[model samples]
Target: MSLPLNEQTVLVTGAGRGLGAAIAAAFAREGASVAVNYRNSGKAAENLASCLGGKASAFGADVRDGEAVAQMVANVKVRLGAPTTIVHNALADFSFNGDARSKLDALTWDEIAAHMETGVKGALNLIQAAAPSMRERGFGRIVLIGTNLFQNPVVPYHDYTAAKAALLSLTRTAAAELGPFGITVNMVSGGLLRTTDASSATPEAVFDLIAGSTPLRRVTTPEEMADAVLFFASPWSRAVTGQNLIVDGGLVFN
Candidate 1:
């Protein structure tokens, strides 16, 4: 039951740059028509689309808004095709500077809610909007981007980690519900990626420390993680669902 990548349409959210961009590129390489969805990085997204050529295009939509997401999907259907594969990789405005993170005592509910709005709520919006089309087609692939911190929590990124934990729950539950409709829901969790917009603030020493701790002895790149994402959407993983594949240079084993 391997999907013919050349015949599929993929929608990658927050794909203007970073891991999202890499993921979009991976799918395009497989001959899938890709919709690079971005909230604010319009220029970057368009540039990436051009780089990918005809099979890829940039779309603007805030996943947090259900109506906007619906519109985005509609647009994709018109410009590309109704997306049979969706990658939820959008992140709220955040930086990986541990020193700037809110401590437990100072962490406010609003801060936590901000992450939820994008992670959990946004996922819900995407599923609701895309599921109908997938159900009609009797095929769909939904991949949620997650974090290794949910398992290790070494840095105690309370708010960000908590939202991801919730997303994991959604991944399993959604998988169970959508299975009958031929939709697979899964997650790809990664540790601190070597260099992404969110992790740009991390010092080089931190990267070296993390790399040393991992069995691979190197930081995983966004491109590496993006490759893992492609597996879930490919025919090779047709029977796999409701699972989380962690891609962090073997730092944490699940």
Candidate 2:
């Protein structure tokens, strides 16, 4: 279906800045009431909410924490009605500069667990908290954010990539299970986005190499990726589920 988010309530986690912020704005622009969830970037969230006008508001929560996630959902429901769309974009603090020692032997279990906890556990908690309302209405959309790095395995972001891969699996499983309830779970995986906070530290040469290798001969913007996400959240995708849409400018052919 077309993007008619008017009056739809959407919660976007990690939406204080970067790709998350763009996603939130896109939903807002579509007439959706947006809950801009942030862990530490409260000001950024508020600012974005302002730009979205009255249809958007800022929320605080650590998605990895079950209690916090539940509370955030409850608050959003109370303030904006039952959220029909949920976007799991929250991730543990990760660096893209190849600064951390990501070698398997060099990393500790805690490091790996930390990353997976946010992606897997966070997704589970949000779904549990929001799915009931969706089932009651027999309609919902859940989009999980992933990375294209898993396809080529070039960047040795072992922990981050592993976590995202698990998230993709979770997305598929959730879609299968929630299908009868009219809730669709899908994933949008994109390669290094241009000019986001996460990619600001990436080497210019590295980004150039990726852009050159892409069939489109360019890197994608957060806004472009957000467009893909909006499609899943809109009514047009009611029949689509358990799918992964890579928005990496044709870098990986599925």
Candidate 3:
């Protein structure tokens, strides 16, 4: 019972590049109109929208700001119809350089707060803004981008991992509240992606180490993870909700 995405309008946050961009493209390929949301990468977002053509368009907003998120959703509705699918993939500015990360002793509450602002608070803002319309229509899909590091904790990225764990909790809680409205909230977690702006800072040795450790003997790609995200938004997953689907090629089985 797979659902076709033909008439869906999807809004992907932080879609200027990285996994977010890939997710937006995947939805477009499935014939869904896409709103590519970016906080700072305006040029890249616009270029991607142009490349996508059709109903795809670029939008700008800092997801941390509730007002900004509200305005962005409103604009998307006027331009591409209300988004029936929302992907909360926006990340706080971060580099996946384990060597440079602040260890537990040096980690500050401020650093943790930064990640929470984007990962947890940002998802909250988007869901609050979009849930009303979704409830009215009796249909919606909310997918939060997560990290496998929460389970593996290979490098102890304290701030980032903690934030994602909180987001996972929010996903389930949201599912319980929104299920009656025909909305499903779930998470797509991926391990060290081969290369994204965030992961580009990671050393080659790290990538090789993770690849060798995975059953697939390779690092996952943003495009590959995007495909798993599609399953949550499609008709195939209408009965599923609050599940965390890891897309890291067996890196950490949950």
Candidate 4:
């Protein structure tokens, strides 16, 4: 299934590594010019861009900051092109293996704010910045990288899960609002990705539990989730919006 995104421009946040990098590469393989957005992993992002083998440039910015996000979008337009498609995959400073026991009592407000600020605010920033162009072009695809854990809370990532839940709501609201402008908003939620920097902190036992319980009896890879994101970002989902597709090896079926 080839997605005809040739000559199109896509901006993927958190593209420095993990699922973000895979998603960027997927779009690049489809001949789309990709703007790899990263917060800190500069070298990693550049390396991913190089491997993309297409028109790819890395843009560094904290997606949580609106001003930074606006500037990043400007740079993408000037350097690569106006991004007609946006993939919101950025996350705040969080660790999957972080102290979950202390989260309820010791986690500061700043910690929760930091997480939400990036996932939710960053996603909105990208949408607001790139939506105008998409509307003018009469075509746009906004795919948000969410967590299937929201539906089935196997872990105790309170802040992260809450933020993703809010982002899911935003996806639906954006879809309804942007639908009139030919822009569709959707979400791709995954569970226990095989290997990724973000998931590096996850314990092997956790993966075992999820994999054993899933119907496929295995964990999914970043590349697999990337395929799901590609579907939403491509023309095949033109009539689809406000939908959260969970790609977790059939772990959660709604």
Clashing pairs in 4: none
After the best TM-score superposition of candidate 4, give how far the Cα of residue 170 lies from its true spot, in angstroms: 0.5
Count backbone clashes in candidate 4: 0
Every model's TM-score:
0.99, 0.97, 0.98, 0.95
What lDDT would each prediction earn against the true structure?
Answer: 0.95, 0.90, 0.95, 0.87
Which should have the higher lDDT, number 1 or number 2?
1
**What's the ranking of the predictions by TM-score, best on top?**
1, 3, 2, 4
Judged by lDDT against the true structure, how good is candidate 4?
A: 0.87
Over 1-254, each residue of candidate 1 has an lDDT whose tens digit, in order, gives 34788889999999999999999999999999999999999999999999998989999999999999999999999999999999999999999888889999999999999999999999999999999999999999999999999889868889999999999999999999999999999999999997999999988888898999999999999999999999999998899999999999999999
Candidate 1 stretches with Cα past 4 Å from truth are: none
Residue 144 in candidate 3, Cα distance off native in Å: 0.2
TM-score of model 2 vs. true structure: 0.97
- Cα error, residue 76 of model 4, in Å, equals 1.3
| Candidate 3 C-alpha lDDT tens digits along 48-151 | 99999879999999999999999999999999999899999999999999999999888999999999999999999999999999988889999999999889
Superposed on all Cα atoms, the candidates' RMSDs to the truth, in angstroms, are: 0.7, 1.5, 1.1, 2.0
